[model samples]
Target chain A: MSLDLFLNQVVPVRQKLFRFAYRLLGNEEDAQDITQDALMKVWSQQEKMPELQNMEAWCMRITRNLALDKIKSRKYRLADELDRAGEVPAAQHNPHAMAEKNDVMGKVRQMIHELPEKYRTLIQLRDMDGYSYQEIADILELDMNDVKVNLHRARKAVREKLQNIQVYGL
Target chain B: MDYNQIIAILDRYWEGETSLEEEALLRRFFSEPHPDMPEPLQEAVPLFGYFQEEIANEAALPDMPEIPVVATSSARVVRLSPFRHWMKYAAVLLMAIGMGYAMKQYQQREVKASLAEIQQQKLEAETRMAYLETKKALELLAKNLNKGTTQMQKLSYFNDATGIITGTN
Candidate 1:
């Protein structure tokens, strides 16, 4: 493929790629770096872009793999973000913001974070980024039905946990 | 949207039945709650809000960096064929056996040299002892012979004197 076509097809997905990484890894710096890394990979393989089926999804997959590797390297757990809820009052004096420590969304974030990786990733791709089901399947290399099933289970798991957070104010 | 309609849509949403469009509608409905929005669905407002806040908090993506075109691995990867792998092991085995043989030969040579040195020392010591023993035996023989010779000479003289005297008698 010509450099212009590679530039056109690969460059525009930067924001979406960043968003995907940022959602997966709640760290913006790491997300930006992952986006760059993924893009660089795509650019390196520019000759193959013409035959590539879905450039955006392919790039997203690369970003997803790279982000997951980063997460694993750091031994970072999304589960730990919620675990830090107890430690939130170290310096913040705003009582309202401090109360955000125990907010439902915080619990939801943790619940989503605690999800099995495939479920969490599919949920993030579908619910947070609003990728179409097919796009998610393409990126994740899962069939559409499996994607739907996993997304359903992911949402249900979060909702079930949120039910607990509501009942006992976890 | 009627409260019943929203409730119905949320039911479908939880069951994973809502289309992307329907889900988008739910997000819009919860984006800013109407004053009379159903109390039950109020909890969903933050969930949708969380998604919004999460995606919106994107760091400004910087422009692509200049990726230097590094050489690919295919150019560098040394794929050893099965035959080559066997050849490698065979070469290693041959080297090891050759080294072992060379070492054994060196050791044998060292043993032979030490044994020869030991035999030479032993032979020199035995030769020196035999020479000393022979000298001691010859000295004893010479001493005894000298005493016999003296006795014989004396006898010879006495016989001569007796022959002369007996002839006159």
Candidate 2:
């Protein structure tokens, strides 16, 4: 693909890529940096762009790999806790219902964070990013059946955990 | 989006049978509240609501820096190859030390050349002194020889006087 084609076609989906990266990394700065870096990679590799089948999926895969690399490179990352997550203000809603909603969302975030990498990634792609099974498989380099099975198991696990949080208020 | 239909979709959703569109429908159904919405389904509102809000908050993409494309230039690379960053410093150091060593060696040679000139002058002075002393000694010997010849001439004069007395007189 030409550089102009890459700039117009691949770079425009940066918002979706950033959202996916933010969901995986749980921090805005890392997400933004990874998204930009992924787009820059596409620009750098424009000569090989025509060989790619799906440009959006390719960019997402690059974002995923870069985010995972960032996660790996952090030497002292805490488990289930992002360094900057506490600073982000909760969503503005009715002050009374906002507290309860924020609490539930916090619980859900924790449950998602606790999942194994494969399952959590599948859930993020399917439920949040709304990628089809084939697209998820393409991005993740997994079999289509494996994607479905993992997504089902992941959804079941999260639902069970959310139900526990409601019943026991834990 | 009635309560029973939502419930059935939720069942199908848990069974992993929902298409992307069907899942979107379910997410939309739970994201807002219905008066007839059961409380059991109310618990699921946060999960789907979080996903909707998560994606809906359209974060503006951060500005990307432009990368300039440069054509291949061979001369630029060849000119820059010998002076790597660290090696440049090392080359300067070596040049400085080499200049210092050369300076010291030149200074030593200068000293040696001056010393040789001084020794040659001293030798010439000594030879001049010896030649002057020998000239003085030879002049003294010549004067002594002239004095001895004069004394012999006086002795020969006395013999000539005796010969003249014994002649025609």
Per TM-score, the best of the predicted structures is 2
Residue range with the least summed lDDT across 10 consecutive positions in model 2 chain B: B58-67
Model 1 chain B worst lDDT window (10 residues): B57-66
Pairs in steric clash, model 2: A1-A50
DockQ of each: 0.25, 0.28
TM-score for each of the candidates: 0.61, 0.63
Clashes of 2: 1
| Per-residue lDDT over A1-170 for candidate 2, one digit per residue giving the tens place of the 0 to 100 score | 28667767776777778877876776667788888898878788888788878888888889999988888888525335465355346666688777787777777767777889888888878887789999999899889998888888888887888788888977
Q: Kindly list the per-residue Cα lDDT of model 1 for residues A29-120, writing each as its tens digit.
A: 77789988898788788888888778899999999999989988998654356544553446768878557744766777667667898988
Flag regions of model 2 displaced more than 4 Å.
Answer: A76-94, B56-169
Q: Give the per-residue lDDT digits (tens) of candidate 1, residues B1-169.
A: 7888988988888777788888888878877748887777865666676676555544343544454544545456777677857878899999999999999999999999999999999999999999999999999999999999999999999999999999999
lDDT of 2: 0.79
Global lDDT of each model? 0.78, 0.79
